[model samples]
Target: MVKHGISLVEAARRLGVSQSTLYIALQKGQIPTFRRDGRTVVSSGALRDYQTGKRPPCAYRL
Candidate 1:
């Protein structure tokens, strides 16, 4: 059974990225996540928004 939210591995697979890459994205705040039951969770809406380009990638202003 699928959980309320998706695991980082699943999200990475859907995004065609590696788990570590997703982890880095999480750490860098490129992708949003929240804690649920002591595990990091990403919402489907957020994933969809990312896929559809509704959310921009993290940019560093120097």
Candidate 2:
């Protein structure tokens, strides 16, 4: 599996949600993310934090 990070599309795929829904959530600032190499990259760290109960509730359920 990809370990370092993932693109928004791939992240959505991994989360079993539609890519467009992920995009909409991102635009609404409802997901945790960051930028890398000029591309918006979802933070693996934040995903972990979310999994471990360290983040606010988000509706995506990813």
Candidate 3:
């Protein structure tokens, strides 16, 4: 169980990927994200929603 609103790095960690990999996916739009105070972020709610089929699966390969 993860808390809501975590950093991109932590999101990558939870998904078992390197920060660089996540960044690459982000750059390619293979992953979802939002800006917060000018910082890249991945909300846990989004992740959870994704897991529950709320969002499409990422084409990113780690």
> Per-residue lDDT tens digits of candidate 2, residues 1-62?
44456888888877678999877766655667876778888876765564465765665533
TM-score of each: 0.72, 0.62, 0.59
Q: How close is candidate 3 to the true structure, as a TM-score?
A: 0.59
lDDT of candidate 3 over 1-62, digit per residue (tens): 53346798788888788888777766655557877777778877666764565665565554
What lDDT is obtained when candidate 2 is compared to the true structure? Answer: 0.70
Whole-model lDDT, model 1: 0.79
Cα error, residue 8 of model 2, in Å, equals 0.9
Index of the highest-TM-score prediction: 1
Off by over 4 Å in 3: 1-4, 48-62
Model 2 misplaced regions, further than 4 Å: 1-3, 48-62
Supply candidate 1's per-residue lDDT for 6. 88
Per-candidate local distance difference test = 0.79, 0.70, 0.70
Candidate 1, residues 1-62, lDDT tens digits: the string is 45588888899999999898777767766677877799999988788887887765666321
Candidate 1, residue 43: lDDT:
85
